[model samples]
Every structure is written in C-alpha cells, then in structure tokens.
Target: MRQDEVEIIEREICYQGFYRLERLRLRHRLFAGGMGPPIVREVIEKGDVAAVLLYDPLRDEVVMIEQFRIGARDDARGPWLLEIVAGLIEAGETPAQVARREALEEAGCTVLDLLPISSFYTSPAKTSQRTHLFLGRVDSANAGGIHGLADEGEDIRVVRLPAAEALLLAQQGKTDSAWPLLALFWFAGQREAVRARWSLAGEAPPASA
Candidate 1:
C-alpha cells in the first residue's frame, strides 16, 4: 500500500510528559478494495531507539545490563530486567551514535566497532516506536559496575556472561526483553562470522560523537 492509501481525519495529543500519547482518527484502504471505515487508535509516541548487544570476541563474553523497568514491574520475573545497551535517538544523533554513547553510559564499555544487525518496529500496533539494533565489538575486561544517571532514577547493574550462556537465556525464555532476545538469536547464527570479521578489523574508530 502507499501513503495515499491512508487518510488521517484528525490527530490530538492525549497526554504529554515523560512519554507522549496521541489519538488518531483515520481510515485506510481495505484489502478487498475501497476505503475502510474511519477508526480511532491511540499510539504511544516513544520516539525511535538504538540498541546494541556488546560482545567481546577475545573473551567470548557479552555485556548486558539489569535495571528496573516500570512496565515489567508486575512480571513474575521481577521488575529488574536484563537488557542490552539502549537509548533514545535524540536530535542530531544517529542510531550508531546512540548505540555507542549508551554503551559507555550504561555499560562502562566503549564500542570498538559496530555491525548493523536490524531495524524494527517495536510495537507497530500500539506505538510508533522503532528500534535500530547492532552488534558492538568491545573489550569486556573492565565492563562491570553500577551505571546510569542518578537523576534519571536509574540504578543499572552491569552483567557479563558468556555468549553461549546468554544465548541459552534467550532460548530458554529467561531474558524477556525483545531487544536482547532478537540480538542473541541473530548472534547465535552469526557469532563465528562476526568474531572473525571484528578480530581482523582490530581497533576500528568508535562511532563519531
């Protein structure tokens, strides 16, 4: 379908704070043919995100983070969820920049190099948020510590695990976040190739600030 196939009747901001909620009334072309009835939908405007799965090929380990997520507060697994380095793509920032910056701020590791993984809509049905995922090469020798901005109410704990063990967590459904699960599953298939490629490209420049 094309952009012309959809028509927006009206849009209004329902809420605006840490996150924005917008209510849209629109109609779109139907599969059978013709335009469908106008429908109202509320979408959370989370902006776009950039996330990276940090891997240290030399040590065969992955650096991850654990932090309290309000959305998962009621989850049986608990509110402190394991996740990859991620942050919003602020103005004038590319996805790669966000990935690298978040890595240092949230994981205490500088990304030596980056391999683009995938870009995806986080939840198209309910939100307009999208995510750009990457596999970042890092030296995990000094990758553990409590990180995150205190003013942001973030108390993040760095977690380093063997790449294989991290993949197992994904396969066994232990880590429930979408970002980590997707990255790990992809890594499971490309680990060897990535390790080889990154090893050869020793100490490439970090993402531009």
Candidate 2:
C-alpha cells in the first residue's frame, strides 16, 4: 500500500541528548474496502537499544556484574543489583558490537559465537527503550576482572558463577535486576541442546556461522 493508502499518522523526534522521542500524533483510518473506513490503532515505539546475555558453556556458568544500580539503589530490596552485560546502542554501533564491547569492558572476556535472543521494550509504559538481547559464550575461567569506563563514572565488579548458583541466588531474591533471571532461564532451558549442538560441531565451529 502507498502512503496515501495508509492511516494513523505518527510524529517523532528520532534523536536527542541521550534518547529518541517518538509520538503518535494523529489517529485515523484507511480506505481498505467497503468496510466503513478501516481503522488502525495508533502506536509509537522506540527505535532500539542493546543488551548482552553471556553464557559460558564450557564452565556451565554465566558471568554477571554486581554494580550499584542508581535506579534501584533505593528500591525496597537494596543496592548493587546483578545483571547481564547491557547498554544502549550508540549512534553507529551494531548490537554485536555493543555486546563485544560490553563483554570486554564489563566482564573482561572475549565473547565467541554471539547469538541474538530478542528485541523488546525494557518497559513500554514508562520509557521508550527497545533493548536487543544477545547470547555470547565466553571463557569464564578468566572473566572476572576490574573493567569499566571510569571516565564515564562507572564502577563495576565482575563475577563468574555457576548457572545453578546464579539461579539459586535469584530464587532467594538476593539480586534486584530482572534480566539475570530471564537470562538464566534462557540459558538453562537451552543448555542441553546448545551443548549438544556445540559438541557436534566441535569447539572450533561457529554457532552462527
């Protein structure tokens, strides 16, 4: 269909200091058929952001960072939440690039065979941030290290733990971040199949290749 053939006009500013604002300015209907002007529900969604979920299949572990999350610092729980490697997509960086950069800077590991999981709004009701989730297998034996952007005023502590231990901690409600648990489930649910796939292809093969 052409532009004139569609309806529900939306206006948006796709860039700003730290975000892009989108708005559904007008709601209208299309000339579909004899169906009394086809209607459309107006929708305004954010463009994109990126998140990295690391899974170390070799060690059966996932590396997570503990940091003083200012957003949740004063939540009913506490500060210093556990989360997967995550960040917003910069002006010109791809999701894989963000994943690699975050993996090295936050967890101090070189990720291999990056896999994309999902792209979704972190919270649509409040913020217009679409986060792209990625899965990366890394060498967890030497993952924990002091790595973060001090110039950006970021202080992070990386830690590597067994998948079971991480899930247990989340189950006990120790960490306030939600992505860790989601990642845990994603990784755990696919653990056997991923491992089997990895083994069949050999360590030298690529998951996405």
Candidate 3:
C-alpha cells in the first residue's frame, strides 16, 4: 500500500556491467491481512534517468533522436527507436544537468528553458530506474545531425518534426517509448499556454531543420 508496508529483506549484486542487476528477497504486508510469503525478485538498477522533449516553440516543432535499442530487437518493427533526449543521472549531477547534457549530446541542441513534465518509474516491477521528464525550449535549426560520444559506442541521429506529427506517432505507437509519448501528450494539453507565453516574448529561432 505504501513504502512503509513493503519490506526489503536482503539484496545483493548478482551482476554488474554498464548497469547493475540486484537479486532481492522480500515480503510485503498483504491488504487482506498480515505479511505475505517471502519472495525472490531480480531488479535492474541502472540508476535514474532524465528525459527531455526538445521543443522549438517558435517553429512549433519537436527535436527527437533515433538510436538502436537492444531491448527492442525482438519486435518485428525493429530495434531502432525514436525517442526524446535522455541520459542517466551521474554522481553529483542534478536532473536538470542530465537533461541539458543529454540534449546536446544526443540532439545537438542546447536547452534554453526547461519545464518539468513529470517523474515516474520506468518499470516499477522490474527496475529501480526512475525517470524525470521535461519539456525543453530550444532553437532546433541546427539540431539535426549525427551525434553522441563515439567513445561510448553511440551513433545517434537527430530528427525534427512538427509537434502534432510527433504526437500522432505516439498515438500510433510509432515512437515506441513511454517518456516521449508522455511528454508529447503533456505538451499537447499545455501547448496553447506555452506558445502564448513565448509569443509575447517574441522568441522564435530560425526555422527548424
């Protein structure tokens, strides 16, 4: 029912690579009565992530990224995923810092302003990874290009599309990810207000590429 109700009995690192896999033995208080039987669960501990939707308010467009996702290899649609800019939160780094860094590294754009969208668990049942999402204001004119740190084995492609079209992709499951879809829908409901505010400031960059 709550954090207090769930008890973490024991945890150990079963494996560690770029991320970590933890095997835990635990039990929780049942809603019907007392504590349930002890159970074993494996959790992926990849640390937290920060995801941002790069929005060029003036051009009414969104900057997206496309990259190969190993997890999606079994999907008939292929593993190359279209998603918002994101990266893990490193030690001594804030969510905002991660967002800005991932934006530049993945999409080649700098965030001018960041609007917090939400924070949620990526896979509550299987992973301890939580993601903080934001709507980032940017000038997307030069955003399109091959980016990502080569030393890290990254080969990313930046994409720019009308915000509406991007949302349509989410509705059709084309984007194939949660954070981007969530950001798009959130932006949809708040678009008019954001655009109105930006319009008054009269800050629209050169047309998005």
Model 2 C-alpha lDDT versus the unseen true structure:
0.70
Cα lDDT tens digits, model 1, 1-209, are 99999999999999999899999999999999999999999999979999999999877789999999989989987899999999999999999999999999999999999999999999999997899999999999988989998898889999999888899889999999999999999999998777767764555423311
RMSD for each model, in Å, please? 4.7, 5.9, 2.5
Off by over 4 Å in 2: 1-47, 199-209
lDDT of 2 by residue, 83-193 (tens): 888876778899889889888888788888787777777777646667788878787777776678999778888888877787777778775566666666676677767
Residue runs of model 3 more than 4 Å from their true location after superposition: 200-209
- Cα lDDT, all candidates: 0.92, 0.70, 0.89
Model 2: per-residue Cα lDDT at residue 185:
67
- Taking all chains together, the TM-score of candidate 3 against the true structure is 0.92
Please give the RMSD of candidate 1 to the true structure. 4.7
What is the per-residue lDDT of model 3 for residues 126-188, given as tens digits with 9 covering 90 to 100? 998999999999987777989999999999999999877888898887877888888998988
Instruction: Give the C-alpha lDDT of model 3.
Output: 0.89
Residue 101 of model 1 has an lDDT of: 97
Clashing pairs in 3: none
